[model samples]
Target: MRGWGDIPHFIHQSAGTLRNGPLVQFLNNIDITIMNKPADYSASEMKQISKRYTTVANQINRHRTNELKNQTIIFNLSESFANPNRVPGVKLKNNPIPNIEKIKKRTTSGIMLSSGYGGGTANIEYMALTGFAMCNFAQTLSTPYTQLVPYLRHNPSIIQSFNYAIAIHPYSSKFYDRGIDYPKFGFNKFFYLGNKKAPIIHQKKIGANSYLSDETAYDNTLNQLSRHPQGQFINLITMQNHLPYNHLYHHISHYKATVPANGTIAAQVENYAMGIHYTDQAVAKFIKEIDNIDRPITLVFYGDHLPGIYRNSMKKDGLKLHETDYFIYSNPAAQRLGAKNLTKHNHYVGPNDFIAMTA
Candidate 1:
């Protein structure tokens, strides 16, 4: 698997990422420990590589045919994490999935079932969008955002079939260098807090980093979509619930943290709950506004990964992280046959399986 990096380079970049071109900029800054020099290939080999890429692409596109064509799809990569149930000893005043029971009736709901892999947002986003896990490449070559996303010229996302596709992140485009990578995933438009043309959200400070409120991000997304009349795929990666949760939000005192006072963990726990509360409220508000849209729409919301302050389910020795919650929401307009009522899924949903399961 160590030598297999070149295969993705050839399959994705036509020859290898060594040549002077779009991907060369990324390759130029590489350390040999991760990637050595690319194998030299003749021009004839480059032609063959292109042919192979086309053949593979055609086969994949054929196998993964799009199911929902005209329906609007919004996939929100919510930050941090929280479970549906109350953490023992903590009082949660806010419903994380606000009115989830009521909203469940309006659409199909289920757990996106994820492994306790501490891969973070970029890896999960790659899996959810491509329906392939990090293990597809070697785990050592982790984070497709930096490794694979920079090389690809095309994508196989379910949203490729949509008439319009856009990406919005209420954070820096440079955070993961997503500014350069999203286009490779077939996003027709990209908006971020760093982009002046994009709607800027008033951020709240969570520790040293400024966090954009989910409420404002949702409104900006809605505003962006208002011009497009459905058949749009919107990827919203949120940032409000990021780490350094030591600050206190008085409004959420009702959902007080039960952890020991004066510890780093206690502050994180308290601030985290408050952050989750705000996220829940944002979802409720987003739902209320989008429900009025005349076109059919499907919204999928899931936490990117568990935050840094918390530990996995294991008390002494456990590698597993507690799975985050994910729910698929179908508005009245997008309800399909037999999907009039919310459906529950019993199986665990891998991040890669999100596209197929949600569709």
Candidate 2:
């Protein structure tokens, strides 16, 4: 029968000679095992075994071919890793003193708006002007200047220009999809110095099974900072510290029992704390970048809205609910301009008031 005896000659031939004689002997034994089979085996049985073996061999061959292809592609891409031509040089020279003075001037009447998570009282527009006492830039502009409407108007031509603006709604992919077409708005010319696409600032959602990489987030933030510079205000809403958490404890196998009924509320708190730690690290890197830059930068950092983990859940975990909180970290320009004693107020503040207060 056409069985093990017909083991492909190419496979054996492709097996390279080993540097060690003993290893060669070991491979010979493997070849013998591949070749040898019981003569008494039925024709159907042999056929079934051969089919299974062939199926496995084909899968392995395809996998190996793909691996080689991927390796070659990676090697080629790596050659251009640090090539200067691949990375375009910045056209704008770093502006020094006036940039700082500009920030100071802006903050003299400027409002910085920051919002934490959740809907209702903590919405972005409401929080900016209400919670922070800043002006609503959106309200001043009509349909042509509205967030999604203008971008939808512009389309492909907007994409051609490097200038683009992206605003992400709290937790929706629809917003991002709409943002992809933002350049279509005629305002593209208004925002970009040249014909450029506007950049979108959005939030990231971290899943329970997901691994949080602060470095990746930092890289993304840096890339945004580099691209936008002074063109657009970049806002980042982070989910690193999001709650009702599950994935946070995946890394620690030992404490699986200690995690609460809903994955141990206390452990979840710790996980949330860890998430905040990673977020803080990311923010720290962002601050460093601003400090390094010669231009005056205003960075407002604060919570969108506090997580509502349920009163029962909190009691079960022996925790207490607290009022909403916000913090701002600004450049020396903002500070020198008298951005001081930004008090922590306890009230149901909305977005517009938030911006107005800060302004």
Candidate 3:
């Protein structure tokens, strides 16, 4: 987990945009390179590599049994949705995410060990979609969407199992080069703010919040779902709970910290909690709506990473800071179709394992 402030440096050195330019030639001569070296393998070795990846892709494609083919799978990549109690010496007056807590008790829920602590959102998204871990990549490969996706010939992803696959993010599509990379990942369309193919249908936001609310995200998702009679795969990355948490909610819950902290950090935590509180309400409502639908549907919801607001408690929390809440929930209609069998009972997992665990 590196600071996002250093993204420009990573991009300048690793992005494929420099390909076929003098800069690349200069870097190559100096023993520095961004583009991956062409595979140095004999015909037999190439055949083996091809076979390995093909086997993995085939396994994933065949994992979704016929009974589960009609089930719509929605992956909700919630932003900065972490448990406040996990932070040392911090306590809230009331449970901020009671709805999520209740759902976790009944559903296949657990902790997801995230790749990034504060801001590696795209990497987690990549892991969930492609079933590839960031840890397996070179340490210099910080943002694969820019550094790797452009150069890859094929992208085998969970989306291949569905007839229709779309991505919904209530923010800029250009971030992390998603607009350019989504098609490569088998997505049919991307719905984001001002997207030309399919614009974001819902744009409602919370009080003083710069990002759209989870309610609106769900609304837009539901709208998209209504149009596709065939089961669809939706990758929804929410933005409501993103950074700059300053007193965004009308009703701010007071969080009493045993260890003294600055006023700004305290307010950020309170505002972030309130944000998740709204997400809880929205999630409960969304599930209720899914329950009433005739079609089978399953939602995989989890936070991308913990917010950067807890600088004070980072060292104390350690790896706990990289763990966020997640659950694999099937609607009653899907449960009746044995969608419940798709998930394993394991209580802890990594984002890279989600495709295999759920499919």
By lDDT, who's the top model here? 3
Off by over 4 Å in 2: 1-126, 129-172, 175-218, 249-264, 313-322, 336-350
Tens digit of per-residue lDDT, candidate 3, span 23-125: 5433433432334555675788889999999999788768556544467999999988888777665667778889999999888888988878778888899
| Candidate number that wins on TM-score, 1 or 2 | 1
Whole-model Cα lDDT of every candidate shown, in order: 0.65, 0.35, 0.79
| Model 1 Cα shift for residue 127 (angstroms) | 0.7
Winner of 1 and 2 under lDDT = 1
Residue 214 Cα positional deviation in candidate 3, in Å, after optimal superposition: 0.8
Give lDDT: candidate 1, residue 127: 82
**What's the ranking of the predictions by TM-score, best on top?**
3, 1, 2
lDDT of 2 by residue, 1-359 (tens): 12523322211222322222444434433422212245677889989999999998788667332221111000000000010111112111212113222333433222222232222222343234123232333332211112223324333221222233333222222222223323342223221112234332232434452533433444545565566554333334333444455556443222222222443244443344445444545555665676675544555444444444322343432212222333344556445544454444523343344333433
User: Candidate 2, TM-score vs. the true structure?
Assistant: 0.42
* Alpha carbon lDDT at 55, candidate 3: 96
Off by over 4 Å in 3: 1-69, 254-264, 313-315, 341-345
